[model samples]
Target: MIKSMTGYGVANVENDRYIISAEIKTLNSKFLDFNLRSPRQFSDREIEIRGLVSGVLERGKVNLNIEFTAKSSTNLPVSINQELFETYFDTYKSMASRVGVNDSSDLFRLAIQAPNVVTTVSDKSDDQDEWEAVKKVVMEATQKCDEFRKDEGDTLYHKFKENLDVISKGLDEIQKEEPKRKERIKNRITNNFKDWMEENSFDENRFEQELIYYFEKLDITEEIVRLSTHLKYFDKTMSSSQSQGKKLGFISQEIGREINTIGSKANDAAIQRHVIIMKDELEKIKEQALNII
Candidate 1:
């Protein structure tokens, strides 16, 4: 079945000390393009994460983000800069004495709230347990992404089928008009022959042979058969268990070629009109196929 290249998915996995969340978004592209964002602690896993996404997505522009939040107090290390705090306090005390101010009450509080005075330092240690948990979440998110693509693919499948049917119906109309088309062409050609016959005497056998050749040039039978075959093949490819975007594109091109040939060869106005409608439907199919993966 066909799969669309655009989708989104998210998953969260948590353990005692950490909660890892993964979010993935995809857009249609001719190749696999991965953009990843994660906490500095998990930077080492970027390569592995990309491999996982590329393996499943196959093709598209992928945005994968991972967020890790330490839920347990034991996992968080917050510290205050004691030396900086002391420096600020001494300066404040000196200024208060010089100004003959008796009050220095809020100096400690003000110093403690200074910029960069307090900060949390992450443990750079790569815990195997945490990495494993994050990996599982990544995989789960990717699975959900694939499911989204499959669901969108189902919608595209029906859309393509509907458009193909429209083209098929147009072909049916052309078939219905073919006999009348042939008679019109014959009458027109016969009138032309009658005018030529008045001008000069020509061999009847040669005239018959030349007329046959002209009729062959205008015959759309081969085009009709080839177009039908292409339509059938297009439908068959949708059921294949692999990516059929490129294949479907090629089939649509073939269908267009036959349609154009019929339009050029058709001498009947009704048949030409049917060919125009076929072209319109084929264009819609091509537009939808670009999003297939």
Candidate 2:
């Protein structure tokens, strides 16, 4: 079914030992994009998350953030790398001998600056558990995100349906006055011939040809039919099970084409005014399509 690109959902997990949360927010976009804010240790999961989002959301400017909390600080002790320390200490002693600042305090300071010599007592197994928790919350958040998107989609569908109805009313007005417009053009041309044909013999064949050409040019029946078809297609796509943002966008483009043709072809002042109103309604529908998926 139609789903909006704009939505927000959050999911959380709580336990005696740990709590975790994940959130997803989306905005309109031509293609899928993501801005993920998460711990560095989980950076490797970026591709997986992207695939998951693409499968469900299809298209959007999506942003996600995940955070974890522990009820108490980890009690793991500090760790020191003895081999790394020895390498750093020897290198520092050599440098100190060269510079002639051979003091124990200076050696201690230099050794402290070495990378990986002292490190946190982080557990590899603990990391796996943390990832699992993150995955769980992310799944739950996606469920909520789907529900949120559907709720927004329902509202958008109503707005678009209203716009289509307004446009249909405008079309009806234009069609009702169609006969008057055609008659006005015919009368104008006949009056002009009466005034100008007195100068020379009237060219009946040329007048007939010109009348037919202008009549065809002003006829907006085909455009109106196409516009109606496009509107119907748009409504159908919104109810489809597949993600419909791209399809909806294409239908909107077709509708715009039809509207443009009608505007150019219908030279009547009243019809033009109504077309302007239709155009405004179409603009709003196009904006709504951007947020559909």
Candidate 3:
């Protein structure tokens, strides 16, 4: 089944020690473009995360964000290192005495901001279990995004089917009017030949041969055949079990070429009108196909 290139998904996973959340947003793009935001600790797995998104999404402009927070207090709060604070405070006091400044309100604030004076205790040990949980959450979010795409794809599929039907109807109208159009051309040509004969002597046999050749050139039988075949092929492509956005686009181009050729050779107002309707439907199909993947 086809999938749309636009979607949004989010998932959250939690454990006794941590809560992890992942969000992904996707937009249509010619190629896979991945942007990721996550805690620095997960930087080591950035490549793997990118690979996961690429493998699933295949192509799109994707923005992924992951956030983690402690589920329970485990001494991760920012606190002053007492020893470091005392050393900075002692230096500040000595400097204050030397500079003859008794006010120390700013000294305590400045000491607190000193390097290494404030810290967050970390369990620095690598946690494979935690990484696994985070990975599961990421995959969950990706799956949700895939589901969203599938839903959007259904809408696109219906739209494409409707337009295809309209184009097919237009082609049918053109086909139905073909005989009358050809008869008009022949009548016009015969009238022209009569005028020419009255004006100047010409070989009737030669004129007949040229007329036959001219009619053959103007005949849209082959174009109609090809156009019908293209339309059928396009319908078949849509029924396939996989995404074929680009392939369908190529087929649409071929359909357009045939329609344009017919319009050029039509020389009949009615047929030209049918061709215009076909062009309109084909344009809609082309525009919607861009969102498929």
The C-alpha TM-scores of every prediction are: 0.83, 0.83, 0.90
User: What is model 1's C-alpha RMSD?
Assistant: 3.4
Sort by TM-score, top down from the best: 3, 2, 1
lDDT of 3 by residue, 63-99 (tens): 9999988767755457779899989988998999998
Winner of 1 and 2 under lDDT: 1
Residue 279 of model 3: what lDDT? 94
Task: Encode model 1's per-residue lDDT on 137-216: one tens digit a residue.
Answer: 99999999999999999999999889989999999998888888888888988887797898899999998999899889
CA RMSD of all predictions: 3.4, 3.6, 2.3
Check candidate 1 and list the clashing pairs.
none
Model 3: clashing residue pairs?
none
Question: lDDT for every model?
Answer: 0.88, 0.82, 0.88
lDDT of 2 by residue, 43-131 (tens): 77888877766677777898889876778865645688888888888888988899887687878777876888778764333477777
